[model samples]
Structures are given as structure tokens and as C-alpha cells.
Target: MKAFVVYCHPSEDSFTRHVRDSFIKGVVDSGNEYELSDLYKMNFQTDMTEKEYLRDSNYRTTPGLAEDVLAEQRKINSSDAIVFIYPVFWTDVPAKLKGWFDRVWTYGFAYGEKSMKLLQKGLVLCTTGHTKSELKKYKLLESMEKVMLGDRLFKKVHDAEFIVFDGMTKACDLREKNWNKNLETAYQKGKNLFAPRS
Candidate 1:
């Protein structure tokens, strides 16, 4: 199986980067192939150009998408599954990734008269500074899931999942305590991503 991994992280000295590496290792160990798009490293353009906005707003399928946007679309079509790895910022995806959705998931491709394929799976792995309980306490987790799984990824993939590694604040004791465990979970998720379940 092949997976397209969209990794968005600004700093290499971060736990989120480690998660990405661990997951990639698991994918390799499972004998699966992957294509990685390190958004920050690639300096991917996230802002939608005026022309892009005009095209989507008018629902025009003029095949005028930018080369970068088309490249991302091609990656999606060529993969069996899609994996998104990032660190949560302000209870939502980082602005870079959100902008990616804005640009890459164009109207014709992800919505009306869509030609995008229904992939086998869509997985989101996000790290949060807040603990899971804290997130649930304010219903932030549910809201995050709704936006990601219920809306953005909705109908775009056959199956989708949102997984967060919480309590990763720099000051939190649990951050260091659970670091290995969190990465192990990430690795396992990658290993079993394409495995059949009965």
C-alpha cells in the first residue's frame, strides 16, 4: 500500500517531528511505501491566489490550477491513503495546513462535480499542549473532530480518523513521561493503516 503523508511543522526540534519520523519508520517496516510532503520544508505556498479564488468562487473548471496545487492533487490521486501530521495550534490545525486545505481542496476537485478519488483511509495525527481531559472539558476535542472528520474530510475518503497526542506542553511533566508512548502509538497506527481488519 502507498500513503501520502502531509507533514507540517516549522521546527525540527519538536516532538511532532519525532512522531513523523517514527510513523515513517513503521510504514517502512510494514513494507508499505509513502510519499512525504514536508510543507514547511518545501516552502509550499498556502495562500490562494486571486485567480484561484476567482476560479473556486465561480465554480469554474477551466483547468487553470497552479502547478503546486495540481501537484498536491496528483499526490492524492496516486495514493491509497492520506496521512496528515501536525501540531495543533489554538485548538485547530496550524494556519499553514488550514491554508493548504483552502488552496488544494478546490471546488471542482473536493466538492461539486468532483473528480477526486475516494481513498482507502484518511488519518490525522495532531499534537496538542492541552491534556485530553482539558480538551474534552471544553468540548474542544469534539469541535476539532467535527471540523476535520465531519466536514473537511467528509465524503473525501472512505474512512477517516482523528488522533491527537495531548498533554505535550513544554511545562507539563506528562509531556516527557508520555513521549515514548505517544510515538509508539503513532508507529502502530502507521503499521496498521493499510492492514485489513475483520
Candidate 2:
């Protein structure tokens, strides 16, 4: 299997980067091919230009997608599975990632007689400052899952999963305690990404 990993983090020094590396290691160890898009490293253009906006709004498929957007679309088409790795900000994906969806999931591609390929899997691995209990108490975790799985990835993949490595705040003791465990889970997820559904 080939997995396309979309990793978005501002710094390489962070734990999220380690999560990414560990996951990739698992993919490699599993004998699967992988492609990575390090959004921060690429300095991807997130903001939608007016022309791009008009194109989507008007439902016109005149074929003027920017090269960057087309490149991302191509990656999606070529992959067997898609994985998104990021850190939660304000209970949502980072603006950079949100903008990636806004810009790259273009008209006639992600929607409107879509050209986007339906991948075998869509997996999201996000780090959160709040503990899972805290997020569940307020139903924030459900909201995040609904947005990512029910909305953004709806009908786009055969199966989808949303996993959070929670309690990652610097001041939280669990951050250190669960660090290795969380990464092991991430690696396992990658290793088993293409396993048959049971």
C-alpha cells in the first residue's frame, strides 16, 4: 500500500514531528511505500486567491487551478490511503490545514462531479493539549471527529479514523508519561493501515 501523509507542524522540534517520524518508520517497516507533504516545510500557499474563489463559487471548471493545487490533487489520486497529522488549535485544525482543504479540495474535484479518487483509508492523527476526558466531557472530541470524518472525508474513503494523542500540554505530566505510548499507537496505526477490514 502507498500512504500519502499530510503533515502540518510549524516546528521540527515538537513532539508532533516525532509522531510523524515514528509513523513513517512503521510504514517503512511494514514494507509499504509512502509520500509526505510537509506543509510547513513546503510553505504551502493556504490563502485562496480571488480568482480561485470565484471559480469555485461560480461552479466553473475552466481548468485554471494553480500548479500547487493540482500537485496536491495528483498526490491524492496516486495514493492508496491518506493520513493527516497535525496538532489541534482552538479545538480545530490549524488554519494552515483548513486553508489547505479550502484551496486544494476544489470544485469538480473534491465535490461537484468529483474527480478526486476514493482512497482505501483516511486517517487523522492529531495532538491535543486537553486530556481525552476533558474533551469528552464537553463533547469536543465528537465535534472534531464529525468535522474531519463526517464532513471533510465523507464518502471520500472506504474507511476513516480519527485518533487524538491528548493531554499534550507542556504543563501536563501525562504529556511525558504517555509520549512513548502515544507514538507506539501511531506507529501501529501506520503499520496496520492497509490491513483488511474485519
Candidate 3:
């Protein structure tokens, strides 16, 4: 199977990067070909232009910007699975990563006329947070569901199996032993999710 991984993180040494790598390893071990788009590294822009909206009611009309959109569409079109790896910053994904969705998952390209469901075959979300578990428990889970799945992505894609593994506040865990274990488990979950169906 082909897999497309969208990684969102600014720091190269971050736990988010590790988790992304682990997922890639798992996919490779499973003998699947995959592609990756590292948002921060690639310098993805999340802003939507007014002119784009003015042009033909299509979200991606600019020629230069259209290329990026088409590239993402091709990746999505070619893949059987899609994974989003990022660290939850301020209760949301980074702006650059969000921009990838804004630019790539266009109205007509990624969705339209109930045809938008085309992108949802095998989608998974892998995320981490700087806040501790207690913090999340105390709060309302920071509305991750609404922000990530509901507003940004879920509705844009079709019906598919989705899961989350949130590793929190790893900075306090300097050694990262516990964090690594959690990441390993999450990687296993991702692997299982993409394993060939029986």
C-alpha cells in the first residue's frame, strides 16, 4: 500500500520528529511505499488569498499556488493511507501545518458535491502536546476533536478509521524514556491500522 505522511514540527530534535520517523519505519517494515511532507521544513504557508476565493469559486486558482495544491492532490490520490504527525501547539496544530491543509485540501480538489469523500480511505492522526495529562484532564481536552478532526479535516475527507495517541509535556521528562515508550506504542497502532486486511 502507498502511504502519505504529513509531518508538522519546527524542531528537528523534537519528540514529534521521532514519532514521525518511527511511523515511517513501521510503514517501511510493513513493505509499504510512502511519501512525506514536513510542513515546517518545507515552509508551507497556511494563509488563504482573497483572489483565490474570487476566481471561479475555486479555492486554488493561482498558477504558482496551484502547483503546490496539485502536488498534494497527486500524493493523496496515489496513497491508500494518510497520516498526520504533529505536536499540539497552543491546543492546535502549528500554523504552517494548518496552511498545508488550507492550501492543499482545496474545495473542489479535496472535496465538493459529496465528492469530497474521496480522500478518506485510511486516515490517521498522531499528535503530542506540551501539556501534561493532568492538564488535559483538568481542561476540556483543549477541544482537539473540534479543531483537528471536526473543523480542519474530518468533514473534508470521507468515512475512514481514525485514531489519536497524544504524548504530553515531554520536556519535563528529560530522558524521554516514558515518552519513547508511548511513541513506540503509537507506532505499533499505526502499523496495525495499515496492516493488510484479513
Model 1 worst lDDT window (10 residues):
189-198
- Total backbone clashes of candidate 1, pairs 3 or more residues apart or in separate chains: 0
Q: Quickly count the clashes in candidate 2.
A: 0
lDDT leaderboard ranking = 2, 1, 3
Best by lDDT: 2
Put down candidate 2 lDDT per residue, 154-194, tens digits, no spaces: 99999999999999878899999999999999999889989
TM-score of each: 0.98, 0.98, 0.78
Error of 2 at 97 (Å): 0.5
Model 2 stretches with alpha carbons more than 4 Å out: none
lDDT of 3 by residue, 1-198 (tens): 777888888888776677788778877877777899887777766776765556426543344546666777788777766777877666666778777776676655555533233454445554554434644686635576656656656655454444445545455553354677766765675566555445
Residue 129 error, candidate 2, Å: 0.4
Root-mean-square deviation of every model: 0.9, 0.8, 3.5
lDDT of each: 0.92, 0.94, 0.64
Q: List the residue pairs that clash in candidate 3.
A: 46-99, 111-116
Best-first order by TM-score: 2, 1, 3
Superior by lDDT: candidate 1 or candidate 2: 2
Model 2 — which ten-residue stretch has the worst lDDT?
189-198
